[model samples]
Target: MAGLITILIDGITYASWLFIVALGLTLVFGVLKILNIAHGSFYALGAYAAASFVGWAASMKWAPGLSLVAMLLAAVAVAALVAPLTERGLLRFFYGRDEVLLVLVTYAMFLIMEDVTKLVWGANPYYVSEPYSLFGNVDVGKQSYVGYDFALVGLAAVVGSAVWWGLNRTRIGKIVTVVIHSSEIAASMGINVSRVYMGAFAVGIFLAAIGGAFTAPMISVQPGVSVGVIIVSFAVVIIGGLGSIEGAAVGALIVGLARSIAVHTAPVAELFSIYIVMAIVLMFRPEGLFQRIQARKI
Candidate 1:
């Protein structure tokens, strides 16, 4: 029973951060119709930025609790600075181009950002371990867990609820939804689709960055961190159905539990467990567990 509880807690904790990242990926795909191979790069930037920001905060002798604020600011800064440059300066030009072309473009951007991160932060790993103990520890029955992990679970819940409420209950969200359905029609209605596109992209990048920010303390902030995240995030969105908020959530839980189980039971299968589950899901539901099959428009 204790072992089962540990697995469940570990799975939920892992799913929390993943859901945050995958939510952004799905949002970008839903609104902009771009798969955004560079999304993981933004996540890396967030971690690097968080490491810098939190370090600065510590140097200033700020309360350790405020490191959380620094991490959040890091995410906001990345979104504010990078989103415009990527969306307007580069991706906008490729609008209406072939989807394959867009994918290649984003892949190129990913490669470029990989080099850029090394150039700025260098190849050395950065650590933000200070924030990891902010929440101290929580005892769960016979097992003990980091309080920070439970905090992440709460944060994920808040993020998901906020995004859902914004999209379903707000005027701008309705406009964005219309644009998602038919950007041309929305533009004809004087909705300013370009601005909507930029807004959605910024929000998506913010989600990715925030995921990285919080996760910085949990792992080494270094080059190649984005690679693993990108692979798993893609798996999540694919399993949940691209562009689906609910799908992202469910997919993350499934992946997280699968990985946790593998790690606890069969360490050798840890790497393949996620992919195996993804393959099985794809076999049974190619459109994903949540995505409906839409009739092709003439």
Candidate 2:
């Protein structure tokens, strides 16, 4: 029972990380109707930025727990700088184009960003563990673990709830939902689709970046980390029903728990476990479990 509880807590932490990355991807797709492959790049950039800033902050004479704050700011700054330029300058050109074309553009952007990162930060991996270390430790049974890990679970819950409230219970969220349903209609109703697109894209990037920043304390900031994050984030988005926030949350939980279980029950199939569940879900509900919007006959 104790082991199971530990596993569950671990799963929650993993899910939170997944949510941080996937939420942005889901929102970009939900609002802009485009799958930004650059989502992963944004996350990578955030991690890199956070790592750099936190490292600098640590070397300086600063207060305790400041590095984590630096991490958050670094992520937001990166998103603020990158998201607007990418969305308005690059992604805007392909707004009304085919989905594949937009994805291709974002993929190309991701490639360019990869090279750019190499130029800026070199090829060496970087890391910062202040956030984890600051949270100290907690004792459970005969085990002692970082308190930050458990705190991260609570933080993830707060973020998820806040995002849900922002999307469902707020005026801007309602607007965003309407735009997602039909951008054309939303525009016709006097909404500025361009502004909406930029805002949504920025917010998405913001979430992804923050996720990276959060993980900077634990995960190594490697050049290719973005690649895995992109893949896993895509799976989370698809499993969660493309544009559904609730689906994203549930999907993260499902994938995280499955991965946790696989580690103990079937290590050989750990990688395939998620895809198997996704395939099963897709087979029964092609449009997704929570998707209520129906397609019309063309």
The predictions' CA RMSDs to the true structure, in order, are 0.7, 1.5
**Model 1, 60-157: lDDT tens per residue?**
99999999999999999999999999999999999889999999999999999999999999999999999999899999897889999999999999
Tell me how far candidate 2 lies from the true structure as C-alpha RMSD in angstroms. 1.5
Please, what are the lDDT tens digits per residue for candidate 2 over residues 39-157?
A: 88889999999988888887896675887789889988988899878888888888879889988898999999999989999999886877778888898776777888777777678
TM-score of each: 0.99, 0.95
Off by over 4 Å in 1: none
Error of 2 at 211 (Å): 0.4
